[model samples]
Target: MPGSLSAYLSQVEEDGADYVVIDTPPHAGGTIDAAIRAADLVVIPIRPGPFDINAAAGTVGIMKQTGRPGIFVLSQVAAVGPEGDDTAAVLQELYPDVPVAKARLGQRKAFMQALISGQAITEFDRPSSKAVGEIKALFREVRSRL
Candidate 1:
């Protein structure tokens, strides 16, 4: 994010690119504004926790003002029990137009293990508890929106 991502995005579109993804650090700034200006959609990742869900709302507001769609990905959720309902209710209350699908990335030790070893979950161990299944499902939803 050296300058406005919008500047780069403008250049890419001029060159006939279909899409561009710009990852900025977890903060709001000139770079974020630029990226928002350039994007058709914004994807905000929120852990299934109160604080994280609140943060996702702020991001969605930015996208709304910028005339871009903002999607939420709930991560680090408990695999079972009442926690899912709590998180889902919070999201449903906020951005009902954007579908918060039932699929999620649960909290798991294997994810941390893979990250520590500098490998993707699929590349490190596809068969370990099958979190890839969840990731794949999430990707499909995202793809359909795009």
Candidate 2:
């Protein structure tokens, strides 16, 4: 039962959301199988590290099995120094089918600040320029997917 799986696809259809951002557990469990089965497009978040890139091999294959288009988002990118570029370069070679060409969501303290205050980044700090820019660009990018 490698690719055979069960998910809330029927409920998702009924939920009527314009998009779904599924956060799967970090393993090939029933949950991941379910999400893959339900997803129309899989966006794999990659951290710049050896193990992280290796993990993506399984991720790419799993997403492909669902017959869905996929993309990779480089997350936790401190800076594109040797380590970051090296990781990205290797990932490109590994999962050529998945687009690893999106803007990196920089690791920002604002995210933690907003989370601690129990607010979305948009509402967390109206005057914080960083939060405003990140939220705006994030929405714009997501909207482009449609």
Candidate 3:
């Protein structure tokens, strides 16, 4: 873990990166533990589902235990539906101390296509894609806290 953390931080520092985003696995592991310890802020992306919500709780617990600040970003949300709101509310209620991002990412084909095409959503096709906007907004929300 030290080797991994050193390599990861060295690159970010050497490259003069403003932010380093680490995507942890669904379940708890050594990598996640190291990340939470090394992170300035943790971003937990949760889907509006029973399993996801349950998993997020465990992640949030790790954050709290480590005395690390974290935020929840509701991912793959419906564009116009009650599920997003209801899920956010439930999450907030469950973890009152953790902050949830107002900028939610809706389920979009552009996101999947961007991965398949090996390109960013902003670079995939249309510059005016809502997926791009959503990501930018999420970045802003995360950056503002830092």
Candidate 4:
């Protein structure tokens, strides 16, 4: 599987693809390792909770093993609360090597609504919507890292 993934990623690069985003499950395994090996930068999403923060260690360990850089993006964060900030602080304290993204994806109906409507938040919601802005900010952060 790793060989296949490497081959596919090579083809994607040769085909002039600007980027190939690969989403993997939280647990560690061959596929996850292979994806990490193939990735230039890994984006680890963490919800605002202790369990979620602890679970991220495995992926962070894999990234370390492969000597690849990664950034943590807080997802499904509460719209009004310190949970998001506190979680980010804990993550930074625990894994000082990995940076946390400045943009937090707040828990919003638009995300689910867009999925149900088979459209992205950028398309499903108005441009000025918070969800749309959050998505755009995340894109910028990820792009800057790449």
**Best-fitting candidate, measured by lDDT?**
4
What does the lDDT come to for candidate 2? 0.70
What TM-score does model 2 achieve against the real structure? Answer: 0.77
Q: lDDT per residue, candidate 4, 1-146, as tens digits?
A: 77888889889989999989988888848989999988889999999999999999899999999999999999999989899999999999999999999998999999999999999899899999999999999999999998
* Ranking of all candidate structures by their TM-score, best first: 4, 3, 1, 2
Cα error, candidate 2, residue 136 (Å): 3.9
Query: lDDT of each structure?
Result: 0.74, 0.70, 0.86, 0.93
Say which prediction, candidate 1 or candidate 4, comes out ahead on TM-score. 4
Flag regions of model 2 displaced more than 4 Å.
Answer: 1-9
User: What tens-digit string does per-residue lDDT give for candidate 2 at 20-74?
Assistant: 6778755857667677767776777777888778787777777778777777777
Better of 1 and 4 by lDDT: 4
Q: What is the alpha-carbon lDDT for the whole of candidate 1?
A: 0.74
Candidate 1 per-residue lDDT, tens place, 1-146, comes to 63645577668889998767777655666677777767776777777778877667656776778788767777887878777678778888878866676568888887789899999787776764568777778778777778
Error of 2 at 121 (Å): 2.3
In angstroms, the error of model 3 at 85 is: 0.4
By summed lDDT, which 10 consecutive residues of candidate 1 come out lowest?
A: 1-10
Q: Sorted by lDDT, highest first, which candidate order results? A: 4, 3, 1, 2
